[model samples]
Target: MSVSNPTLITFVIYIAAMVLIGLMAYRSTNNLSDYILGGRSLGSVVTALSAGASDMSGWLLMGLPGAIYMSGLSESWIAVGLIAGAYLNWLFVAGRLRVQTEHNGDALTLPDYFSSRFEDKSGLLRIISAVVILVFFTIYCASGIVAGARLFESTFGMSYETALWAGAAATIAYTFIGGFLAVSWTDTVQATLMIFALILTPIIVLLATGGVDTTFLAIEAKDPTNFDMLKNTTFIGVISLMGWGLGYFGQPHILARFMAADSVKSIAKARRISMTWMILCLGGTVAVGFFGIAYFSAHPEVAGPVTENPERVFIELAKILFNPWVAGVLLSAILAAVMSTLSCQLLVCSSALTEDFYKTFLRKSASQVELVWVGRAMVLLVALIAIAMAANPENRVLGLVSYAWAGFGAAFGPVVLISVIWKGMTRNGALAGILVGATTVIVWKHFSLLGLYEIIPGFIFASLAIYFVSKMGAPTAGMVERFDAAEKDYNLNK
Candidate 1:
């Protein structure tokens, strides 16, 4: 029960502000498209900030910091890998996804685009992709919920289960009201706040402990490995951790924002802004964790048991520095990171279920109004499922987040990267790629592999399976013609 009165007051104010923003955003949304894609009228700043915020999330606040606290400098490479991957996603995927998505009758969902673009008139691709989105995103959202629970427990001394529901309810309330417009706009605001908090916290913590010289000296004094870039991580561990960037290619929540951009031209500006924000925020966060190790090392009594839970480093620092007001703002920044991402993902998952699954397969004649309600209902349903899984706070949110990311990356990354460039990608290939990639991830994650590698093994085997299967089967004539025409025009623009 380390609840400071000022901190509690600040937390209430932050929650109120977020709820207000969600209500304000709700007024702007008029329909499903408006709700899901903000009517495709977003600017460069909103797109960049939303994309970056959603991509980073609890991992940025918890996972990145924890990694730095545990392993030191080597963890920075994960930030590097992510920044590089995000830059490429913006450069290569953003503009094209925007144009092609609109050209294909303004498709709103990933499965919708996949089915529509390749003329999968049978709707198999849409249904399959939608199911994958729902399944993976459920787990993904669970990870975020768990992160929220951790934040509540860390900052407010609340029980994990109570914190879990509160987190889920707060996230869903805003998302249901504001939809995509609200989520993106709030994400932009949160991203700015996150960047400020990360930068300021590290500097202040470092300053508190004498200076940079003393901070480094203290970290080195604590553990020699803390000073080494290759600390504790073997080559395999290093590569696996860093290779998390691969998930960028297949993330639906990320791609949906890109596809929903108002114009391709916005991507260039968005990239510059997005990359700058990511590097600074992620870089600063890692530095904070490293600084925390020293801050606690010097004043172990002040930090209490926080040193054990690396995620609490930021909260612990907040309690130490500044007035209650500033600390509240800092705490809100962490919640902002959690809520922004959780809301965006909930919307994306809901859209997939309503548009791709229910309307496409379950009810072909569903009206827009009915579909809208279904989307809302689906959001509630999925949020509850995530909350149920999140009850056990001990589960590693970072590990779950990583597995979900890798699963999506392996399953759809190769398929999507190929769809953009290779004209010969058949329906069979896409289907095979999705199945093989998804199956490999599941098996590798749970079952003991028969003397095979871990994360990378799945990616390699799945990718090869897709390629090999495509070669053996003749291209679906319908898909070959459609893909050929689309590829020609797509190439000409490039």
Candidate 2:
């Protein structure tokens, strides 16, 4: 990258700051608990922003805006679904998970939680959940890698091949060094950058396009149906867009935030803060895409970049509309978005392999120091795998994220929700839910069935499997007692 270029310079500085934060957090990371879960010490604001940042990823700035730019408001049903889903997740799942995971056994990973909560002596739940985390998280990490590479390729004129490795380097470094605490701390900073970019970019776009009236007129002249939400769409299409919400219930990275919150009481305040941040960021994303339709229509001379790849709408707009120094700051938000989520995902994957697999089987009596090193090693191993997966320049951020998001939501969402609410949920039932949910998503996506989002089928089938398989047998008295105790604490805290 040229020192003469302000944007590249800003990116270097921002990445350097993140690594520095990781170094600081590393000193505090004394054991596996600190590395994997911040020793469950996050406060309300940190939990709120970190959760929102990790949840949005590059999808908020790149994928979702690109979708709206390509399809207009017809695509915004996704925003609606996501907003509703997020609020519900914070309300229903956040407190319960915080209480239950701690109560069950102070579990560090989702697999650990499942095995502990259900008393899976055979370790089947841990293995299956860990397998699912590995399979899906590898793909999820690739999406973040792809997003970062896209930003670097555009800004620094690096070839996609070179950008792939370049973009992933800093995220991998900090995550490998400091683990979860590093990821969460950086996420708070990234979330602030993302909102600033989203909010500022759109207002300027609207103003540049001669305000809302001229923008809407231009949009109408270009595509009359662009303003209609139900235009050029089927019932199934709308429902499919809204189905995106269901996936939120099952996302492991977001759930990890809830698990890491200091207490259920902190989660109460965090829910409010997180939802407000989410709604504003999402609204700004929609505004950027919607107003982009008007700006690009009236100024087709500069629209070729966006027309060729709609995902670059925000990027192209920032470079063209702002001064070099201002654009540098604005563009760093993309890197922030990419790194924040990618780092969290890498840490989560590492925890899964280390806590759930390596520590459980390879070294049952391993010391905390050994486990921490193993976790760090797993972060490197997973990042390399994700980089290789992301090397193909043709990968789309939205598509990769959708696949992984569905897998987690289907396989774990129903089980997590049901386990927390129903004392009768059995091990066999939880196992059945995971199998069916994961299977349905893969089969549905493979066959392109019903032209519907895979998460819907996967979530429904998993919930059904859990209910039916559970009814066929009785839960042990020990299971009922455990659930009651967790429920009592959850009620007291909430």
Give the per-residue lDDT of model 1 (tens digit) for 115-214.
7666777888888888888888889999899888887777777888888876677789888777888789889888999999999999998889899999
Q: How many residue pairs clash in each candidate?
A: 0, 0
Worst 10 residues of 1 by lDDT: 448-457
Candidate-wise lDDT, in order: 0.80, 0.92
Please list the residue runs of candidate 2 whose C-alpha ends up more than 4 Å from where it truly belongs after superposition: none
User: Compared with the true structure, what per-residue lDDT tens digits does model 2 show for residues 1-494?
Assistant: 56788887888889999999999999999999999899999999999999999999888889998999999899999999999988989988999999889888899899999999889999999999999999999999999999999998988899999999989999999998888899999999999999999999998998898888888999999898888999888999999889889988888999999999999889989999999999999999998888888889889999998998899999999998999989999989989899999998999999999999999989999999999999999999999999999989999999999999999989999999898899888999999999999999999999999899999999999999999999998788887887898889988878
**Cand. 2 TM to true fold:** 0.99
Each candidate's TM vs. the true structure?
Answer: 0.94, 0.99
Q: Cα RMSD (Å) between model 1 and the true structure?
A: 2.4
